[model samples]
Target: MSNEQAWEAVVVSKSRAPLDGSNLYRRVTVRHDDGPEEKIRVAREAWKQIEVGDRVMKEAGQDPRRA
Candidate 1:
């Protein structure tokens, strides 16, 4: 399948250095049709929040792949 057809997104919470030492950064990646995937990365304990948003959107019949 084409990238667009195989679209998927991931939200990640990962650690950084210095300012974040041992802390995690939350990130999300959403696929697009005519350009690079969209990515939003942030700090704080954001994994649950981000994932919940994703799930809500999905359950509401919104396809994250279509933008």
Candidate 2:
């Protein structure tokens, strides 16, 4: 079995925070139908491509053995 997992979620909110001198990072909060809300950090450009109420698929986790 693979250690990776994916979920379908709805975007709840979005925020931005300073990364370095002038760079910024975006944080997106999403809620799953069967789970609590989760916050994910994404690139500013990628973040701009999504909006609240949008449905998105999120994936995480990796098997070290595959590395």
In model 1, what lDDT does residue 57 have? 20
lDDT of 2 by residue, 11-48 (tens): 88989977676877778888877878877776656687
Each prediction's TM-score against the native? 0.29, 0.69
RMSD of each: 9.3, 7.0
* Candidate 1 clashes between residue pairs 3 or more apart in a chain or in different chains: none
Q: How does residue 33 of candidate 1 score in lDDT?
A: 39
**Cα miss at 23, model 2 (Å)?**
4.5
Q: State each model's CA lDDT, in order.
A: 0.39, 0.68
Which run of 10 residues does model 1 get worst, by summed lDDT?
A: 55-64
Name the regions of candidate 2 deviating beyond 4 angstroms: 1-3, 19-23, 59-67
